[model samples]
Target: MNTNNVLRQITYEIYKQRTVMPEKMRTNYRIERANGGLLCDLWFLTVGCIHDAQGGCVMCNYGKGSGVVHWDKILGELKKIVERLPWEFEDFLLTPSGSMLDEREVSKSMREDLCGILKGIRTKRFIIESRADTISEEGLDFVKKAVPDAEKYIEIGVESSNNWILKHCINKNTTYEMFQDAVQKIHQAGMYVTANIGLGYPFMSEKAAIINTVRSIKDVLNDGADSVVLFPYHIKKGTLLNVLSENGMYRCVSFWSLAEVLGYFSETELSKIQISWYKDYFGEEKSYICSSPGTCPNCERKVLKELDEYRETQNPEIIRRLREYPCSCHAEWKQQMDRENGQIDIKRTEEEYRKLAEIYKTDRQLLEQEIGIMKDEFMRRYGNE
Candidate 1:
């Protein structure tokens, strides 16, 4: 028998045993490439989760979200990787799921110890994915000590900025107050903030999206977010969204609209504000989709490479359309800044104003059917003065 095959079988058997247990917390994970670099493949052997007493996110699968046994064993596997991999590469990071369930004090101590190990190994960087609510002052302080001087980014799934939508429909159990506090703490820790935001959910509106998107970039969100992940609403299996779809209580955002959202991030206008934060971090382009935020700096570098390639392949027409796209957040921002700076020559052209109106109309027709059935309710849920 092949030695590799035997090892594979043994690993699979162990994964299966852990997975099939009634109280099973561990899950099998695929060793996939993070982005465009080496040493970025997450070898997820010995990975797992600790579930909530209330089950978990209504949108989560017990398999994809779960099936990993524990973060400690996962950490051990990474340590083994450091022992085995080529010496030239940068370090691997540690990230955990169901992060809410981890022992707070122990987690901090473990990360401190991890920092000592990686520093000894001369690793380059480390990052993590966590909940907005879990990012307490104490936790931020701990992470700061451990990851001191590394280029760190924290990805928080903020979902939506609208308190009503996040509270009533999504049931995330987080408050706007908590989100604000987390942002302040993250900033205090001297790290980059990445927001995981979504749009076009059940009661989401184009205008609300515009306002929230702007708030995220301009107000509190701008203060922290280095990159904004514009996650569109996709129907998943065994989730509240899927149930809503089945009962016709919701409609998914169109793929075209989703493209528009991406365009929002790609705009040169956002570049101004994003740059306001990073005075020295200047470049012509917008954000890069870091393949694995918490794991691979190598992949992140490659992601920047690919983003440049993507920008090169696009035509001026697409770019212009993006410039004119409604919520011309970038241009509006420039205009607003110019006004404050006493440079008043900048005004959106009549055509530009009309185009923004057209964008709203087009995006609104997206919810035509459901809105027709529930016009007053839609207005109450989504409209702004």
Candidate 2:
């Protein structure tokens, strides 16, 4: 078998052996109004991800729960969340650890209870997050049957259409072909496909990250995705990204980058997707990397306010206004992007060296020198670093 295949088997073994903490198997819920008249009641299931055994995505911390708990108990907890939800919500978003439809992460019994909750709530529409490999037509069909009266939409994490980034950078263990197939099947079932595109992968420059994200969005939309959600790269504790950040290999994208990327999309295109990121999703104690409150103390308020306004209105003029908002660090951000472009694959190379340095304590200086040489050579080849 190939290396990834072998790794997958090993990880599955690890998952099987790992213990689950019942208390951690919790849920997080929130309510928000979407553009037009859609009221969204969103929630996250803490029952850990199946892929966690294989090392979860670099930026994801949602799979923190152990899925080893009792299905009935998990269902009982979800019922409490259902009770907390407002009496009426037009759209219900259930994004659990990994794919909500994945029976491994969310047991069949748990899924049944989820379906019953949807029916009981009588929502006009509902959305679920899923990975490409686990999204089967039959599973979605089951959801449709359960929510016969409501419109069903599936949100897949098509982080990047580029296979290299998906595998090497994000460790998603999914392919573009798989995503395309999933989207095709979702559309075949007469359901809307919403893809969440990841931005700011470590190995590439900001410009490259934006280009890849925009391309993925267009490709998926062209393929069958009705909408796309932009997830700016963020770091979390205990993830590979956190390690990289400590080594000065990764930096979180500023809000300016978010604005620049969204500005690239047309007003009509912007309206189709979800982009209200300023409202903290993780609550008080949970920490997020690169998502600082605002660009600066003085500029943050206006930037966040404008972002919310643009998300609701999708007015090109609002984006234009944001693009013009002057910040002291704008020039520095541009220069950083340019230098990062020139540096090219530094993050990947640095990651390998980091692992080696951690193993051979005495050789840390040698590793640093080697990285310096690599950077110098890169600069020589591409004008500047």
Alpha-carbon RMSD to native, per candidate: 15.2, 5.7
Give the per-residue lDDT of model 2 (tens digit) for 1-385: 0013322332344344434433653555666555545455445455567676565566665545553555566567778777666566667777776677787776676677677866666577778888888888668876787668788888888888866567545667788889888888888888888888877776566677776677777787778788887877666654556656776766776777787777777777777766745457556564443343247666877887887776666667877887777787766666776765533465665665556356334255555665675556555644542
Q: Give the range of the ten consecutive residues with the poorest summed lDDT in model 1.
A: 273-282
**Please, what are the lDDT tens digits per residue for candidate 1 over residues 1-385?**
0011211222232233322323232322222122122223232322233322232332332233344246566566556655554443242344554452145413555556555645533335445656776776666665566545566666676666655445433545565556677777778778767676665434344334444554544443445566555554544443444544555444554323333444555444333221101011212232111111111333334333433333334322443453344444334433543443221111221232223224334344433332243344335664664
lDDT of 1 at 12: 32
lDDT of 1 at 29: 22
List TM-scores for all candidates, in order.
0.54, 0.81
Our model 1 lands, by Cα RMSD against the true structure, at: 15.2
Best by TM-score: 2
* Model 2: how far residue 296 lies from native, Å: 2.1
Which ranges in model 2 have alpha carbons more than 4 Å from their true place?
1-25, 37-47, 276-279, 286-294, 338-385
